[model samples]
Target: MIGSMPILLPVLEPDAKEGDGKEDDSGDDGQRLANRCFVIGPDGGIIARYDKIHLFDVSLGAGESYRESRTYQGGAQAVLADIGPAKLGLSICYDLRFPYLYRALAQAGADILSIPAAFTETTGRAHWHVLLRARAIETGCFVMAPAQSGHHADGRDTFGHSLLVDPWGEVLVDAGRDRGVSLFTIDLDAVAAARARIPALGHDRPLTI
Candidate 1:
């Protein structure tokens, strides 16, 4: 788990400029912000890149509305990258609510998952910890969540409490209600042990809708 300090004011792209009535320039401005994924291999080579899939677009108190989709383009696929002894799965903020995506990645052999988010204070307070722990328990995988905290240049506030959880629903490292990176030396044996105990993935039953 590596949580960096909140990005106060990320540079907005020229194409991501708001208030432009033309749809052709709808997502131009968001391209300016740096939303990239670097899959560092055991031999130290960047093997894959997975951009964010969802945008933060909501209305808070007092008629304040944010439309992130206006500036950013959604990612097309979920990425599973190999980094030394771990198969890491990548995701971002809003992707937490979607369990199917995570399940698909786990099925594809992801043992460690990464969810780097810039979550809002309201939602984070309500659901962040629970959702993260749940994802870990459900998939029987280790979860690393690096977050963006504090206020941003756009006047939006973010709740940052990055966490690193083991496969058995235990938080190994918690970066409390502040900033900075939180690191942990994960044990792959824990993943194997947890999966051996529960074996939920092998017993997944097809539900009929």
Candidate 2:
């Protein structure tokens, strides 16, 4: 559900291709493509959709840089949906780095966080596991991430280690660098137990910056 989807360009704006790396102010400063994720119910209906709020715009050395904002528009709002057994929070790839969004979702009653991503080989090798585990530990919510692996059509490589982490920061499943389906069982009761033991989510206080 996390992938490329195109949107109509604003009438007064000029068309800019995906890899242009040019700044765009049209479409209210949004991109022509959206990095969107969806929540689907078991009955084959769409429950909710979340456009990624954080775009991947970084330099990875070797004269390599990505400007996702040039092609994909970032979402302005966080989304939470009811998926029968649990309340789910929807987020696309780059949004994983933003811990505040996940915390807000957890505070808003999300039992599971879905972060589907296409992380590059470089960053994924370094920060993938730690970040995912950190988010689960911080929020006490089960995390289910599905990532793209191997070479891509754009001459870029992705680090694919699809993961499922429990609320207690236990890795239930780790689908290594391959293309296949991974299945794991998650116990929803663990969420409440973890939170009851830590209780960090309830300890937040207003701070002055």
Candidate 3:
């Protein structure tokens, strides 16, 4: 597995009173609300740990609400860890929306990127595949997204289609709507070849907007 920092946070107690002055109907803590990391070596032994930088806490209608800020602390820095021949860039779900982060990772020599997410069904269905492909095409890096699938204990549904995309914006492998591990062997040479062909990373002209 890629060695990146996880943005960790603590779980918070629910608010005592609702707008109706009734007991709030929040569920028990079933998930570990912390940013945690596990470094798996070639032999499959953990080698490091890094916390996540961002948290997901929002109410997406239908009485669904989350407040991750109340539970976990935001991560302070980005993690760039070495994994075999690749410099892996680590990020979570919402982080994918920010292109600058991916650009920075590319500039920092990241050949592979990981974005593990529990995306909402609505957003994932609309933009998940397109966004993943775009990032891969833009950065010339392999993007591996192992996502949380199906409904959670809290009655929240997540879009679960774990994807592995290559530098040329090709879908290498897709684990569709399942709760199991998927393995893939990616050739690192593809990154260099793609970057060499396009050379977009070196063509940054100051433009007047």
Which candidate leads the pack in TM-score? 2
Give lDDT tens digits, candidate 1, residues 1-209. 12321111122233333333436445343353435566554455556767766667778768667777665656667888776566878887788888888888888888988887877878888989999998998888899887778988978688888899888999888897786765467788888899899988778787997
RMSD, model 2, all Cα superposed? 6.4
* TM-score preference between candidates 1 and 2, better one: 2
Regions of candidate 2 where Cα sits further than 4 Å from its true position = 1-31
Per model, how many backbone clashes are there?
6, 0, 12
Query: Mind giving the per-residue lDDT tens digits that candidate 2 earns over 1-209?
Result: 22221111111233323444655655454436766665655555677877778989899999778987666656688999887678888787889999999999999999998888889999999999999999999999999888889998888999999999999898999999978987556789999999999999999999999
Where does model 1 exceed 4 Å of error?
1-34, 42-44, 60-64
Candidate 3: deviation at residue 147, Å? 0.8
Per-residue alpha-carbon lDDT of candidate 3 for residues 1-209, written as tens digits (9 for 90 to 100): 23332322112322322133433234544222446554556556554444556667677777777776555444556766677567888777777887878888888889988888878887889988999999999999999888888988888789989899999999998898888877667889999999999878778779896
- The 10-residue segment with the lowest total lDDT in model 2: 2-11
Give candidates' CA RMSD values in order. 5.4, 6.4, 7.2
Which wins on TM-score, candidate 2 or candidate 3? 2
Alpha-carbon lDDT, every model: 0.74, 0.81, 0.73
Off by over 4 Å in 3: 1-33, 43-46, 205-209
